[model samples]
Target: MSGREPIVPLVRRFSPTLSPSDDESTDSEAVHPYLFGKNSSGWEVIEEKRRCVIIADAGAGKTHEMLARARYSAERGRYAFFIRIENIREAFASAFDVGDAESFEKWIGSEDDAWFFLDSVDEALLQDPLAFEEAMRAFAARIADARERAYIIISSRSYAWRARTDRQLLDQLLPYESPKANEIGEEEIEEAVQTGMSDPNKLTNSIDVVILDDLDEDDIRMFAAHLGASDIEEMMQEIKKAGLSSLSSRPYDLLGILTKWRSDRQLGGRLGYLKHSIAVQLDGINWTACSIDPSILPEAVGRIAASVILTGKAEIRVPGSANDERGFDPIEVLPDWPRENVVALLDCTLFTDAVYGVVRFRHRDIRELLAAEWFADQLANPERRAEIEAMLIREKYGERILTPRFRPMLPWLVLLDDRIRREVTAIRPEIAVEGGDVASLPVEERRSLFHSIVEQIAEGKDDRGARDNDAIARIAHADLSSDVAALVERHAENDDALFFLGRLVWQGQMTDCLPLLLDIARSRSRGLYARIAATRAVFTTGSKEQRDTLWDSLLEVPNKHA
Candidate 1:
């Protein structure tokens, strides 16, 4: 529905490895025979392979690749069956209900050579793992019994496959079972096992596994060229400087960046890009017929995004009329705005899905970022801020004070609102506050807060050491001199916490905290590792004197521990 053209992604093939939880010895390194042909046709890469399974992160172009492969095969006068795994059960049932393998083959015209591309196995896995397994087994059996007339290809998100103990399900689906005993020999089994086959007795060599690689520098340049961006190199430089390299590596995120860049020419961070992209879309709409004020449209959409994310629903259905009782009405959230106007605003943004009046953010990250923005806006009003704080600190649903999915949003939320930061700090004192008005607080109150946080760290009141580390970085970001000193003094004895603090200071370029880090590096009570970490932090902060002092301290410390 969005006018952007899809980009074909490069992929590499490897032997299927069991998940880390299942097999610790499984090779983590990617084994290859690269799958993408020079001409960008998968058919050329897998012509000799009978079965292939492609796994990738979400939005890494799995669906696009499958479609491209189907097109390429069709151009070569081969029949290709593109089945969305979401509808696999239905598709298989319709074709297989003819009763026997012969009838099924006739129904789908699979008697001739064909490519069966099953897209989004991850969706089926999530929707119903058992049904998915059963369908896959059935399909695999059909191919196995046939006279080798068809090739099967399946795709899934790598995380979905790894999270489920369904390795055997995949094994069963693969067209890799050995031929009849009369047709195969014992020596073949040994060869298969030697070549890293999952099951030696089965013809595992027939299956090829490929993982999609993230976009590299060349890919980014190609994408920029495709977008017809004049200052492509300049845009790439800005993207990296904004800490958006991770986003750029994913096709969908890269598209979002390019879209925003085209309109504004200045790319902010990830959230900023998303926000601006939404703005660009909204600006293109003709709002003359809308009853809602243009200024309030984003707030209304943000509320919908927040609601779905907070409630942990992919989509929320708003009633069409007053008598309808489908769910929470979007109209109720914004009393002044018409429901149609709110829906229109949502439909315009790339981040939201609004079909038949059911609305949700398109991606979890988009929902969380918008939700954070919504909370930031609400915090501007004192009453609304109190309500949000109350909701955050207490359980709104069974055993969930806040959804685990919302945890990543906390840092951004606090960064956007000083009041929310202070409240979060009060509730979880060991957590960090970024950009809070700590400098304006009364001296004794500031000291009391800092001391309490240090005591919490000393006693290990919060076992989530990562949160403490984030807090330390946040404090450094705020440049709270006293707070930094207190944290160093209290956490000096804990190597893990000290290392995290040092790394955060170094990464954040918190030069003001360099002196405090130097003191820790020179402290006799600290261990060698913690001292070394602090010394590294001092050196990274560009203080020559502190670096020299750290060198002296490192030498004076015991050599055995070093």
Candidate 2:
């Protein structure tokens, strides 16, 4: 279960829309082409058409599906070229000497006998849309007649391929406001579409569009079984109870959950569970040679993640390399450790060596989570906090101190502490205006925003509110500043605010806020909602002595209903 399991989930395939006279079906049908040879016969029909567009969201197993297809084709005596679309040009250049269609056909031996799996076309388009489109058009033109000789399968995100009715696929593929589309007349547009340049639907009259369906109950159960869970039904119940149904359907998220469940049976908060799972992975790695303290490994990894986020580069060069001048050395963060040991520790888990000896996290989500955790840890150090704040503020004025990808880290950044939240809002005031950054507003506005946010959380008006609360819990666990403590005290009388504050204190394990919670728990003036929240917070967060006193006070109340 640690390494990727070979269990292929069910997949659904749909044929392009067609006229009734076309005698083609548009309904999606479940297929197990990767698992059973008999089902692959239908895949052969798709292969005969020699063109397919696989569409799915991020982490939806599009790459895995394409890889599985390639494996199946290989088993059937077909040579499968699994090429990442981002490197498609390089792959083509290296594989064939001639650029023309006839040369390409001759190079492959028999076009009809080869299967080409082009993965992540959307990534290529995202990096350089215009260049990708031009290259794709040229490639398509070269292989247009070779369709019978080769099968070409390309994968893209749904957003990248979903064009307006009035907009041709080429137009959508053009860079934002690029004049290339305007330069092309309708005739050229139609020609490009017909030639299958960017227009996946027009690849052929019988193109198959396979949209990956989310995992169902059976898939989840089967996957859980693969993870070696003792009771599949109970695991499914826990997944549903955690409101992780949508996440469970995704392969990566489901794997993360399974990883955590294998280590710890208790299903906690999503972030905590994911972090724990990552820790378990790291712990299981044989790092005795590194000689680094296990306790500080997460902090070191978090620092690396922060560097990746700020630099906007997934890969980090090894220490002492010419590209490592940006203070990316693990020794810079873990001063007590040997440089080689630090490198070994980094190579342990959660990261893999990339091209040129650089390293990158296993997943973007893991990087983001670790960056957030690192920022939270930084809040306790005034110098580090100030340094980060100055850097962020400088970037706000377009100095480009941080990468644009760093923006996703903001939600997690603000959750470190109220002071950190305030600093972040000052850097991006629009966040406050949008009701997302509440700590920097004027006292009255902050109060209003806090109440609104809490109400939204209570009513579940926005799915994002839960994420916000999760962030809030991260910072609340730390000791609160006096100013923030006072703000909480003012709202302690308001039942909604008080309940939210109690939950924050409980979730954060805020030792500084325990006295207020204790007061509320012992008081009669506060309503039932406030008192109940306070009682829970005290019992969950207070010291043993404080809890005993609170218990005695609760028993002393003559009317338990009151």
Judged by TM-score, which candidate is best? Answer: 1
Candidate 2: where is the Cα deviation over 4 Å? 1-51, 88-110, 121-150, 157-210, 310-360, 375-403, 407-562
Please, what are the lDDT tens digits per residue for candidate 2 over residues 152-192? 67776553443221123333332122235656567757865
lDDT string, candidate 1, 311-382, tens digits: 544445544633232225666666777656755555564433333345444444455566788978887887
| Candidate 2 whole-model C-alpha lDDT, 0 to 1 | 0.56
Residue ranges of candidate 1 with Cα displaced over 4 Å? 6-53, 67-158, 172-176, 180-201, 205-209, 259-266, 286-292, 307-364, 375-562
**lDDT for each of the candidates?**
0.57, 0.56
Minimum summed lDDT over a 10-residue window in model 1 is located at 29-38
TM-scores, in order shown?
0.54, 0.53
Highest lDDT against the true fold, candidate: 1
Worst 10-residue lDDT window, candidate 2: 29-38
What local lDDT does model 1 show for residue 227? 69
